[model samples]
Target: MQTNEIDVRVREILRLALKTDVPEEGSYAREDDPNWDSLKHVEMIFMLEDEFDVQFAEDDFAKMGSVAAIVALVEANHAA
Candidate 1:
C-alpha cells in the first residue's frame, strides 16, 4: 500500500478507537488525550493489527503511543 493510504487508515483507526476526530496535521499522543487511555490504547492496537494484518511484538506495544509512531511501526511491519 502507499504511504497516504496507510496514513488515512491509521487516522481512521485512531478516530474510531479514541472516539474523537484526529487532526490532519499535528502530533497526537496518549498523554495529551484523555480518550487514549490504557483500555483505548489496547483497543487501538488490536484494531491496527487487524487493519494492517500485522502482529506486534509485546515490547513494540510501548512504541505505539503516538500517531506518527504507530504509522511508522505499521509501515515497518508491512514492509517486513
Candidate 2:
C-alpha cells in the first residue's frame, strides 16, 4: 500500500483505539499521550494487525510509539 494510504488507516486505528481524533502531526507515544495507555496500546496493536492483515513480531511492539513508526512497521511487514 502507498504511504498515504497507510497513514490514513493508521490514523483511523489510532482514533479508534485511543478513543480520540488524532492530531495530524504530534506525539502519539504512550509516554506523551495519556490516551495511549497499556490497554489501548495492545488494542491498537490488534487493530493494526487486523487492519493490515499482518502479524507483528513481539519485538516490533516496542517500536509502535508513533504513527510514523506504525506505518513503517506495516510497510515493512507488508513488503515481507
Candidate 3:
C-alpha cells in the first residue's frame, strides 16, 4: 500500500476502534485520551485486522498500547 493509503486506513481504524466520530489529525491520541482503555484495545485490534488484512504478530499485542505504536507497526508491515 502507498503511504497515503496507510495513513488513511490508520486514521479510520483508530477512529472506529476508539469510538470517536472524528479523529485528531497529524497527531495520535494521547495515552490519557478517554478513548484509550482496555475495552477499546480489543475493538482496535479487530478493526486493524479488518482494515490492514494482516493479523498482527503475537508480539504486536503488547506493543500496540498507544496510537504511535500502531502507526509504527503499520508502517513497518506495509513497508515489508
Candidate 4:
C-alpha cells in the first residue's frame, strides 16, 4: 500500500525470521550478515509470504539479498 506500511511489514518479517532488527541499508550482505544463511533465508521467504500474504517465485527468492532487497521485493510484489 504505502512505503511505511511496506517497511513495517518487512521489518517485522526480518525481526521474526532473521532474529534481528538491524538493517542499515547497504550495510548487510548475505555472506556476512549474522542471521543470513541458506536455511534461514528460506524461512524468511516463507514467513514473508505468510506474514505479508505475498507470493514470490523461486527465482525472485534467489534475487533477494539484504533486508533492503527483501523490502523492495515485497513492495514490488505487493499488489500481485
Candidate 5:
C-alpha cells in the first residue's frame, strides 16, 4: 500500500484503539495521549497487528510510540 493509505488506516486504528482523534500537527506519541494507557497500548498493538496482518516483535512494540513510527513500521511490514 502507499504511504498515505497506510497512514490513513493507521490513524483509524489509533482513533479506535486510543479512543481519540490523531493529532494533525507534529508527531504524536502514545505518551502524548492521555487515553493511551498501558492497557490501551497493548490493545492497540494487537489491533494494528491484526489490521495489517503483520506480527510485530516484542521490540517493535516498544518502537510503536507515535503515528509516524507506526506508519513506518506498518509500511515496511506491508512491503515485506
Candidate 6:
C-alpha cells in the first residue's frame, strides 16, 4: 500500500483507539495530547497491528511518538 493509504488507515485506527480525532497535519504525539495516555497508546498499537496485520517489535513501541512515526513503521512493515 502507498504511504498515504497507510496514513489514512492509521489515522482511522488512531481515531478509534485514541478515542479522538487526530490532526490532519500528522504532528500530534503522546507528549502533546492529553488523551494519548499509556493505556490508550497500547490500545492504539494493538489497533495498528491488527489493522495493518503486522506485529511490532517491543522496541518499536517506544518509537511511536507521533502519527507520522506510526505511518512510517506501518509503511516499512507493509513493504516487507
Evaluate model 1: give its lDDT: 0.89
What tens-digit string does per-residue lDDT give for candidate 3 at 1-80?
Answer: 66666767777877777767545556665465677787888788888887887778888877886566777788787677
- Candidate 2 vs candidate 5: the TM-score winner is 2
Q: List pairs with backbone clashes in candidate 3.
A: none
Residue 46 CA displacement from its true place in model 3, Å:
1.0
Each model's total of backbone clashes:
0, 0, 0, 0, 0, 0
Off by over 4 Å in 1: none
Worst 10 residues of 6 by lDDT: 23-32
Off by over 4 Å in 2: 25-27
Error of 2 at 33 (Å): 1.4
The digit string of per-residue lDDT tens for model 4 on 1-80 reads: 78667666776676677787555343454766677788888998898889778899889988888666777888888756
How good is model 6 by TM-score? 0.89
Q: Write the per-residue lDDT of candidate 2 for residues 1-80, one digit (tens) a residue.
A: 89989988898999999998787665455666787887999999999999999999999999999898999999999999
- TM-score for candidate 4, residues paired by index: 0.77
Q: What overall lDDT goes with each candidate model?
A: 0.89, 0.89, 0.73, 0.75, 0.86, 0.85
Model 1 C-alpha lDDT per residue in residues 1-80, reported as the tens digit of each score: 88778888888999999999797757878887888888998999999999999999999998899888988998899888
- Kindly list the per-residue Cα lDDT of model 5 for residues 1-80, writing each as its tens digit: 78777777888888899889886546788778999888999999999999999998788888898999999999888777
* Candidates in descending TM-score order: 1, 2, 6, 5, 4, 3
Q: Which stretches of candidate 3 lie over 4 Å from their true place?
A: 21-24, 30-32
TM-scores across all candidates?
Answer: 0.91, 0.90, 0.74, 0.77, 0.88, 0.89
lDDT assessment of candidate 2: 0.89
Indicate whether candidate 4 or candidate 5 has the larger TM-score: 5
All-Cα superposition RMSD per candidate: 1.0, 1.4, 2.2, 2.3, 1.5, 1.2
Superior by TM-score: candidate 3 or candidate 5:
5
